[model samples]
Target chain A: MSLLSLQSVTKTYGQGQAAFQALAGVDLAVEAGDFVAVMGPSGSGKSTVMNILGCLDTPSSGSYLFQDVHVENLDRNQRALLRRHYLGFVFQGFNLLARTSALENVELPLLYRGEPVAARHAAARAALEQVGLAGWETHNPAELSGGQQQRVAIARAIVTRPTVLLADEPTGNLDTRRSHEIMELLTRLNLELGITVLMVTHEPDMAAYARRVVHFVDGRVDSDQRNTPRETPA
Target chain B: MIWNTLLIALREIRRNLLRAFLTILGIVIGVLAVVTMVTLGNGATQAVSAQVASLGSNLLMVMPGQRLGPGRDSAGAPSFKLADAEAIRAQIPGLAGVAPMASSQVTVVAGGQNWSTTIQGSSRDWFHAGAWKLASGRLFNEGEERAGAAVCVVGERVRKELFGKQDPVGSQIRVKQFVCDVVGLLQAKGQSGMGRDQDDVVVMPLRTVQRRLTGSQDVAGLMISVRDGVSTSKVQQQLEGLLRERRHIADLEQDNFNVMDTRQIAETLSGTTQVLTALLGAVAAVSLLVGGIGIMNIMLVSVTERTREIGIRLAIGALEQEVLLQFLIEAVVLSSLGGLIGILLATGLSMVLADLMQVPYAFDPGINLLAFGFSAAIGVIFGYFPARRAARLDPIEALRHE
Candidate 1:
């Protein structure tokens, strides 16, 4: 069975004359350990798809199944539990808590999971190390550079060992070199840990790192293609 | 969950210490006003009661004329004579003592020091009726009281004013035109229930006062003490009837004399102070409501400012209740801290003010705890709306907030 399946999912805002549809009957499926990049222009509903897939939003119509559990029927709290156990998110803004240290930000998910202090500490430290920030655990987001802050955000996203890592334009704020570095980190996480990755991007170079690219236009998929993923330049 | 929320709250408060203090300022002032007013008022009531009690328990005072409104009668009522005191002492049952008293303001001089003080004259029974203790020397003998001896006792304040630290028992002091020997010194009784100094007087035999000062064979009032377990109201009734009959009041006429019970006076005076205390407390409590509004105001601001942070928390698997709990705990901590600081401030201020006002220091634990608990309740009552607002934010829209 596929790890995630969305069939004819639609999301609309407002009502009647003011109603706006962000997504209109989109179908997608992700197998385990897949690295898929979703590409589109602005207002093309790429972010909407990411939101629905991350369980931060539900479809106005149709079915969403995660491990065959029918996620579309879950209530708010149940969706939260699903997200807590199975998903991780990295944002374009590098949304690390402003005044909090890197290690504490990474430990946030495990804290919500009610992990014991010692175990959470060990897990968060390891996740930071995985993102190449071992000795920078004590630095706050404000004290770190933009690229380093994004690393902390990724560390926080992966600390829970989520089955699927959702990156919503994660490298949209970085320079070329830093963007390549982040793409390399995401690629390594997907290949080494067998974690599924579903990313949204506007940049073709970033999309090239994924094994599959799905192009969205006007709330519908324009093209879906498979390619040999490019290895990171050392 | 509660522990985690509390931790987050403390961290937030520490982050913006000034804002937190300013947010809770209203609560601090509210609690301080309530506690200080109540505590000082309690001390005043206790002082009033203590002074009234020192006048003697189960005692009654019979004064000429009715105590009308704020003024005494314009037509003078007939005064009591020595014979009336003898009649009450001889005829009444359950009676401890009866003494007719008359007083005048006089300047007394001794050893080149002159001081103006009240001079009261009565029989030896006056001391027993007033429960007055003598510090030195002796009260006048029966012969002196009967013969109208020129002997007197000075109160503590009088002694201090005229003689400094020297003993005045053997000294002679001139009262108006009469030269009198200081036979004894009365112990200090501090202030009266009316806030008048009780120990600024001299005492002599009633005959001496009537003959040498006023030159009339009449007394101003009668002090009557009843034995323990005797009902003061019952004695008051008997005294009223006897004095009315003696003064020739008809059946239709109001009694020419008024009977005042000291115990009832104490209760009435203390009750008035208590009511005033409660009024002050209630007025102070209004400020606490204002304080709660302040908390709500600041919490709303906090929710708006942290909109994006809340969105992140929600997206990262924080339950709605968790967000609500976080903001709610922040408000509670702020108000509770205000309560704690208010208590400490009130305690210190109350002690200092009570001392300056010459009243006892009365610490009521119940009022302190009540103020504390009420402040915390204010936080919950006012904090809920903002906290719920924070919890109900749309995660997608919130993340889009600038």
Candidate 2:
């Protein structure tokens, strides 16, 4: 069974004459240990799909299953619990809590999970180290460069050891060098930990890092293809 | 869970310390006003009761003419004489003492100093009836009272004014034209319930007051002290009947004499103080409501100011209740801090004002606890709306907020 599946998902905003459909009759499946990149123009509804996949929103009409459980049928709190245990999200803005240290930011998910202090500390520290921020635990988002801040956001996302990592333009605010560095880190996480990743990006070069790419046009999938992943520069 | 929420709340408060302090300022002033007014008012009530008790706990005063209110007396009421006091002492059962009293304001000269003070005349039983204690010397003997000798007992204020630090006992002070020897010194009694100076007079034989001072045989009033365990109301009723019969008032006529119970006076005075205290407290409580609104105002601003942060929290699997609790706890912390500081401020302020106002310092734990609890409740009452608003925000829309 696929790790995550969405069948005929349709999302609409407003009503009657003013109605706008962001996603219509879209079907997608993500299996375990897969790295898929979703790419599209600004108004092609890729962000809406990402929001639904991250469990931050529910499809207006669709059947969504995660690990055989109906995602569309879950209430708000239940969806929160699912996201807590099985999913992690990285945002385009590198959404680390301002004025908070990197370690505390990473520990937020575990804090909500009600983990013991010592265990949460240990997990958060290890996640930060995995993102090459071992000695920067106490640095706040304002004090860090864009690349370092994005690394902290990634550490926060994976602190819970979620089954899937969702990145929405994770390096959108960084320069080319930092963006390459983030892509390499993401690829390494997917290959070494066998964690599935679903990323949304507008950069073709960034999409080249994914083993499978899906292009969204209007509100439906225009093309889906597979390719050999590009090698990272030493 | 609670610990985590508290930590987050404290962190949020620390982030904007000035704003937090400003937010709780209303609560602080509200609690302070309520506590200070109540505490000082309690002290004043206690002082009034104590002064009344000092006038003799079971004492009764028979005054000519009915007292309509404070300072308003009925006209054409006949004065009591020595015979009236003698009759009450003979007829009344369970009586401690009864003394006929007459008083006049006169100038008394001693050594090189002359002081104008109230001069009172009564029998030796006056000491017992009025609960007067002697600080020095002794009361007049029966021979002196019966002969109407030129002997007097000086009160503390009279001695201080006319004799300075010198002993006034055995010293001759000229009262108007008569040279009277000071036989005793009365103890200080401070102020009376009516705020009059109690220790500012001279006491002498009633006969001397009637013949030498006023040249009249009538006494102004009678002071009666009841024995222990005797009901004052019962004695009052018996005195009313006996005086009415003695004065020969008709069955339908209003009695010319008024009987005043000291205990009743104490209760009435203290009751007035308590009502005033409650009024001031109610007025102060309005500020607490204003403080609650202040909390709501700041919390609403805080929710809006931290929208992106809230979005991040929501995206990271924080339950709606968690976000709600975080903001709610922040508000509660702010207002409770205000309450605690207000309590401390009131304690210090009440003590200082009580000393200045010449009343006892009374610390009532119940009022303090109530004010503190009420301030916290104000926080919760006003904090919930903003918290609910923050929790119900859509994560996607919130993240997009600039």
> Whose lDDT is greatest here?
2
Which residue pairs collide, candidate 1?
none
lDDT of 1 by residue, A1-234 (tens): 899999999989889999989888899999999999999999889999999999987789989999999988888889888888899999999877778889888998887788888999999999999999999998989899889999999999999999999999999999999999999999999989999999999999999999999999988888999978997755
Per-prediction TM-score, chain B alone: 0.91, 0.90
lDDT score of residue A3 within candidate 2: 94
Which regions of candidate 1 deviate over 4 angstroms? A174-177, A226-231, B1-29, B68-74, B109-114, B177-179, B323-358, B363-365, B392-394, B397-402
Query: Over the stretch B79-140, how does candidate 1's per-residue lDDT look in tens digits?
Result: 88888998898877898888899999989999899999999999898999888999999998
Cand. 1 TM to true fold: 0.90
Residue pairs with backbone overlap in model 2: none
Total backbone clashes of candidate 2, pairs 3 or more residues apart or in separate chains: 0
Per-structure clash totals for the candidates: 0, 0
Per-prediction RMSD in angstroms?
A: 3.1, 3.7
TM-score against truth, every candidate? 0.90, 0.86
lDDT of 2 by residue, B98-201 (tens): 98999999999999899999989999888987788999999998898888899999999999998888889989999988899999999999888778898999
lDDT of each: 0.86, 0.87
